[model samples]
Target: MIRRRYIDGRYGQVHLRENTPLGEPPLVCLHATAYSSRSFSALLAVLDGKRHVIALDTPGYGESDAPDGRIGIEAYAESIAEVCPDRFELFGYHTGVSIAAEIAIGHAARVDRLTFMGIPHFRALDFAAWRSKLAARHVLGERLDQFEERWRFFVSERAARLPLGRAFENFVDELKAWPHGWWAHDALFEHDLLARLEQVRQPTTVLNPPGHLAEPSRRAAAAMPDATVIELPEMPGPALDLYADTIASLLLAKQFVGGAVPA
Candidate 1:
């Protein structure tokens, strides 16, 4: 059963809801910056029926508190380590992908596998430059034109006035930031795991969305010999069940994330 409880209540804290007795090592799922664990409630429930699934409200998102005012991706990963210290698997979507990558690498012993869904590793920049770049709108084709129209609608005039930190963050990030504390856009954007994929000792899996991020994400996954790239037909929303059976089988068989099959 999924029950919410606070864990690691320091500067930053998280609300963890998990099933403790699935008789399996937990699959710790981290939602993207704008999202909370609620997004995975459906999929988690299904997976939980077979094996335990642990999802937490990252500091500054969901019901969690952001510690020390502002935080970066590293600190977010650190929070997970403190709360869920046992060995487990890591899964993330979009921005969560970056965090999970470092989490697995930062505490290699704790992570068995690292999975990224809709790997959106979009780079961040100074607000002014960011806007100018967006305005330039490099037209790749009709597809990009359609995307640009949608993105344009997403960014309103008032949003342009928000502080760089606030602008970079979505609903979750804003919630985590202290009421009157400085924001921390610099910390999270400065580093990404694509360049450091080789450092991740855990077996990596990247299932990308059908868009610009796919090609590069696929290349990044290739950095590790143990990595696997699973492509799916274009669809909307998260692909939570694309390989759920395989993941479960791999875990039950003790085929750890280092890409080794069970004995």
Candidate 2:
């Protein structure tokens, strides 16, 4: 069973969902842009009953309150670091990938292992254009129709596999983070992804799913001090939800040895 709770984070109240709340060296999971810890509900259920997993609703995304002013990846990492234990395994998808990398680099002593999907890489020119686009989109309009248009587009492109009710819920979550919804992407595009990855010293795994476009993830994996890259070409589309069993197995192998993390 998943339990809901809150942490009085430095920036604001941070919400979390956990499978095994008291299990040690928990697997700290982060979600992509506009999504919450709820994204990992299916994966949490598949893990063994004794294996602890905590999914954080990153600040400005879900139930958590938005930070003051614009912040970078470092700030986002610090927000999570404040709540994490002395050492834990980290897992993330999309935007969460960059956050996980930042945490590993800045708080190496606190992170034992890392796993991520989609390491974002952007050319200077591309980032400049994206920044302008995101800046314009961040301002939510007054029209309900405009909101509906954006919601429909997001659902069709990203959440098609989800049930209608769940997809709507995601759309609502997106609406809640408006004005700051683009903060994470902006931070990611502005940072040097390769440079950041090079700083991470922990044993890491890059989980590549077919149909996902992320050349940077492969490059980052190759640059890490100790890393493993696993490409699941046959398992396509949002690997986190569709291939929860495969991912859970991988973590179980690396982090769960005799019901505990290896020393």
Candidate 3:
């Protein structure tokens, strides 16, 4: 179920969804651009009974209000700080990983464990090329074959289970509109995480998504001096189950039920 809340310093009443809110020390989920936490529903089910999977519709997406352009990853991190959990585990997918990285690095004391899905950051690939693809100027015409090639990977497998016609249309509508300047704050991602690598202290599991994104991410994990890397394939089984096995192992390895968070 979802609840509307006003986290101080937040843009407005934040819309947060809790999956059976089992208890404190919840597993928190952060989603990518053009996605609400709802996107993770298919993955949340298999996370096991130990976690109270909670998803937030980051401001400017879904039911949440748009934060002012002045906001940065740190601001979103700060908004996340308001979550009154006895303890918390951070899980971020794709663009969400960028935020999780900032939070885990900046507010190390707040996070107990970290999980990053589709980590597009800390890669050898040049950001300039990535930015070019995201540029609206690159897709102003009808003959945009280049963009479609990549956009297909973004489709959900659950689309087949949905009514298809209307549900798919509504799914498109839920994506947060890309307003100018509300995107990737370079300064937020600018700091070299390598500098404070050891400071992460908490166990981190970087799980690449179930597709082509996994290869480069596997390379990224190999380079991380301290992370555990796991690749989940798109086939062989349901995507979420693979994620569950990876995370369960990480938690068991760390033996981190963590400690009590402040009230």
Compare the candidates by TM-score and give the number of the best one: 2
lDDT assessment of candidate 1 = 0.60
C-alpha positional error of residue 73 in candidate 3 after TM-score superposition, expressed in Å: 2.1
After superposing candidate 3 on the true structure, give the runs of residues whose Cα lies further than 4 Å from its correct spot: 1-9, 47-49, 84-86, 135-175, 178-182, 185-199, 210-212, 223-225, 234-263
* Every model's TM-score: 0.68, 0.89, 0.70
Expressed as tens digits, the lDDT of each residue in 39-114 for candidate 2 is 8887888874857899999889889988897788888989999998788989978778889888988888888888
Query: lDDT per residue, candidate 3, 78-107, as tens digits?
Result: 676675364787887766666676677777
How many Å off is the CA of 98 in candidate 1?
A: 1.6
Would you list the C-alpha lDDT of every candidate in the order shown? Answer: 0.60, 0.79, 0.58
Best by lDDT: 2
RMSD to truth, every model = 9.5, 3.2, 6.0
TM-score of candidate 3 relative to the true fold: 0.70
Q: For model 1, how many clashes?
A: 4
Clashing pairs in 1: 11-67, 12-67, 60-176, 203-257
